[model samples]
Target: MKERNILDILGNAEEDTMEFLTEKCPEITDAELDALIDATEKKYKTKKKAKDGTEKDNNINMTENEVSGVEHSRRPAWLAPLLTAASIVLTAGVVLGSVMLLNRHGHNGGGIEQPAVTATTTSVTAAVSTIATSAGTATGTAAMSTATTQTVTAAETTAETTVYTTVPFVAPAAEKLYVDNELGSIALELFKKDDEVRYYPMGGGIECDIHDGIKFAADPELDIWCIDYSVEGDSYPAVHDIAYYCHVTDSKFSSLEEIKNYARRTMSENRYEQFFGGKMAKDIDNLEYMDTIDKEHTKFWIEYRGKLYELAYVGGWGKLPSVFSDFYPVIIADKTDTSYTAYIPLWYIQVEDINNCICVELKLILDPEFNDWRVDNVEQFDGKHYEELYNMLKG
Candidate 1:
């Protein structure tokens, strides 16, 4: 074709597109467009060369020339140095972003861990404070209770100590109590001093004058009631039998010395210093004697009898296991106290068939029934028995 004719079509014709640059561009030329295409081709060659390396190198060189072109358009300087600086800043930003991301992840993880640690610490501290407070309160209450107990114990001890220090008063030791009789004579407080004038060893009731010569008792165990004698309806004396329990304030008691002197004047003043003769008396270990001699078991005895039936005597009765004497009276020097002077009888009288004291014993065994009791027969008494045991003195 004609080159001038092709140039004419190049200005505004598609037919000139396939034609090699016929002449040169009039305004914008085809040579410049081809130079741009060559530069793009060189950048593509660099991208292809980076495909053999790591992903970082591939990504860095993939658009390195393209990035340099962008920089070249902004400022006309050494684009390679500018590209290096931008790459360094981008690398620093990537590193800074990674650090920030790691820091954010650490903060989120630490947030999860902190709440649990704080809750546990707070709970432990609260438990420790509660335990400490409880222990302190318990210790304080225990100390206070101990102090209160000690104070109460001390007060009780002091009160007990003060109660037992003082003693009661007493009457003099040389007086006597007497009663008026219907026969117009005065009868003194009389106690039979015969140590050997009883039917039972530890048990014997009192024997008063029934008429002229005979004497007897209804209840023989409780002898304290017999001391109060009445002259047939002169106020009717309280004690009518051997087992009668007498009143304390109703009867007057002489002083201890006066009682001993009066007993000596009214009764026998001597004691038996020898043993008796009999088959059973020779060997006194027999239990048969224990049954007959128990004052708590028997009814009555023939007074002033001469034979020693080991069952029949006086003095060794009441709470004491063993004692002697016919007189069992509660002497009242000071009526309220057992520690005062008591005229405790210490001998038994053996009454034989006759009305006389036959045998004397210094000591006699009391019945087991007498433990913690004052046996009195007034509750079940029959006055008809007075005539049965009588071995009277017939004038």
Candidate 2:
């Protein structure tokens, strides 16, 4: 779904919005989760303390009023503070629930949310055309059962089983794919998702072995999944690109309006510097180049002025350098979150990193083999936060 429409669905404010973030980002570990929770708790405590002060003032008012000859009576002043605390608690729970859903459904943190989805028993129709075994010794009667109760294992159980029997119910079947190319063909997939082999068929007589590999590292909840698709090679035109995104709850998508509001409010208040109180780009123009990446699985960053602005995108582990350090705002002032390599029609760019500028690289959503417009920087792995995640998720 187009992210623009997701704004209504993505609710990012309303406290504990990171729940949606957790849903969208798969690589977050237990430590990260702890960090997030701790951070949130601290924030809540701070808010509660300030709000409690308001209650104290009201308590003083009621006490003074009761002592005076004002004929009116009122409830305890502490009541409002108690109620506000309760309200905050209730709101936090609801927001947490929404965020969990977003993570499970793989919602995009770029303020897009979808409904939480679980792998229910989808009635996958197996178009079985009885393959007539040519050998005479293969006389067998088979029963094809479409059983819903049949336990399905994701990686544990696969469609590539091999235990033949009179009732050959096992599988080694291929997945079905139906591409709806109306939006726009993804520029990256050097090897189409359905390509028989990990190679590309170019127009000329030349064929390229492009391992459009995408590997995922997901949280145990399986709420969201992210894939890496950086490429490897020595020179520019010989490199690769990457991207991916998983599922997320619809409610999560609806929740991001809060963050947008917060950003706008920060801008309006002119107190964003006081609020965030740290080094983040204060002006939108700082990263205006973000709009350039209009395709899936691509990112556009802004940095560097006179020289080259290194915009980058990648696929596969070998191409990690081009996408990570090479595109970092510090190294080149061009960067993207590595989790974004697999999101098709890539959109989302970090204008500044650590609040600084460097080089800029043009990130191509599906460009393989960087020509004049492309360059390759293939490295096995750089121990990026995302890389650590993919490692933990490997089957």
Q: How close is every model to the real structure, measured as TM-score?
A: 0.12, 0.21
RMSD (Cα, Å) of model 2? 26.2
Tens-digit lDDT string for candidate 1 (252-314): 121223323322332322211111101022122232311222233222212112221111111
Segments of candidate 1 deviating more than 4 angstroms: 1-252, 272-395
Task: Name the lDDT of candidate 2.
Answer: 0.24
Q: Candidate 2 residues 288-333, lDDT tens each?
A: 3213222321211111222111111111000000122223211111
Q: Which predicted model would earn the best TM-score?
A: 2
User: Which run of 10 residues does model 2 get worst, by summed lDDT?
Assistant: 196-205
